[model samples]
Target: MKFLLTSGGVTNPSIRSALDGLLDKPVDQCTALCIPTGMYGHPWVGPGVKAWEFVAGKEEGNPMVGLGWRSMGLLELTALPSLPAEGWQPAVRDADVLLFSGGDAVYLSHWVRESGFADLLPELTDTVWLGMSAGSMVTTPRIGQEFVGWQPPGGGDDSTLGLVDFSIFPHLDHPALPTNTLAAAETWATGLGGPAYAIDDDTAIVVTDGGVEVVSEGTWKALAM
Candidate 1:
């Protein structure tokens, strides 16, 4: 399996290059499936419009387009609770990459389990998994509470998909994401029971099979409990 896990989506030249390397082909030849289910946690409303309508209509301006991938398609996994698997499985199977947006890790993790996509991942060995923030967090065994003050609804399990063994603490030391500081990351790591990575917006952790590489134009650190 391959992954390009970022704090923010392709925010810098090094990250873009890393993604290009993961693609291995020309950017225009690659197809992507954008899963925006994570956004469900951060609902917003606009004048004369419902929150869902506002969010549903705003699929444009995704960073994946700027990175030069071709034919990006949107798939809202949160809405698949009632839909047949046939409706979404083919899009996922055919896509060259699965791009996940950032939001609530707990919320996204629940949808990932409910939508059956977590079970399907083992078969998608060739598809590159691209994640940002919460998207990145869900690939780990657990989402640390220090990273996001929110917990799973109803005091449910905080476990994630565990596609990757270690947790990722994104946006480290970022002024905009004040809670995601290096100090907090260190505190979180102490109880993680495994390894963790603190990556800034300009950095990404690229994993191919069992190998891991940190590609960045900014700062990052690896931690162990």
Candidate 2:
């Protein structure tokens, strides 16, 4: 399996090159499926609008558009929960990459399991799994409480897909994500039973076949926890 896990989506040149290398094809020839389900879990501002709409409106200038993929298709699992696997499997199979946008990790994890995408992932060997923020966090066995500042709803099965053995804390030191400071990351890391990583916007951790590489234009650190 291959993974391009980032704190922010394709934020710098090094990450872009890493993504291109993972695809092993010209950018114009690769197709991507954008999964924005995670955004729905975020807190909404306005009163009347639906959650999905509220989240969609906030992503007006997403950086994914400039990544130069041949085509990018939006797939909102929450909006189409009833759609059969057959309806979406073809899109997953055809795409060269699965782009998961940032938002609430627990919400994304819940949907991945409920929508059956978690089961489908292991089978998609040829498609690279690309994630940003909470998108990257959901691939691990568990998302630390300090990372999100609150417990997941229902408090049951908070475990994620466990696609990777270690956990990830994104947006470290980002002013917008104040809860994810480097000091908080260190605290989170101390409680982890295994390894973890703290990354800023311009860094990414690329995993290929079982080996890991850090591709960055900014900062990142591997937690010895």
Candidate 3:
């Protein structure tokens, strides 16, 4: 699978073109899967999932398809009413492309686990992988700085889908998250001894079978784990 990972949601509309390039295209579009943005809880996810399902001609039944996806907070799922016992994994298995959006990484991880989506996501490596902020962070084997202070507050065990070898300190230096998590990112890099990427909202780190590239408006820093 090819990947278009970003620090935040696709603020620059033009970036969608860049994202399309990652896919094999029209014929192979069935293989695409969009990861749920970990904000607004599942309320936001209803639509993103709906869009793809609509395009795919599935037409199951999930809200948010045309209403414009909300900033679905990952933690929001915890408060949502219970899902069917069959759970989310069934739908996930039937899909191909996975799109991820920015939000709370901690809550997103939990939903994957509790919803049984975690086990179903591994084979997606051959499919298209798209991520925003928290979505991008969860792609790495170990999520970066956000998980450093993780506890009950930061959410525990930042277990991502492991699509990438590195972690990310997303939105670093942004007014919303001004403090740079260099220390935490470096610590993860050193421990894993692989490589980690740090990005701001204006930047994106694109990864493919070939290599990793930086795309966006700003410079990014990477460290070898």
Stretches > 4 Å off in candidate 1: 43-62, 148-154
Better of 2 and 3 by TM-score: 2
Give the per-residue lDDT of model 2 (tens digit) for 10-107.
Answer: 87789989988898688789988888778667664112243334234344333554466788787776655689778887887788888787777888
lDDT of the candidates, in the order given: 0.77, 0.77, 0.56
TM-score of 3: 0.63
The Cα error of candidate 3 at residue 218, in Å, is 1.3
* Clashes by residue pair, model 2: none
For model 2, the stretches where C-alpha displacement exceeds 4 angstroms are 44-62, 148-153
lDDT of 2: 0.77
Model 1, 99-128: lDDT tens digits are: 887777877888888888877888888889
Q: Is candidate 2 or candidate 3 better by lDDT?
A: 2
Candidate 3 — worst ten consecutive residues by lDDT sum? 62-71
lDDT of 2 at 112: 85
RMSD in order of candidates = 3.4, 3.2, 7.7
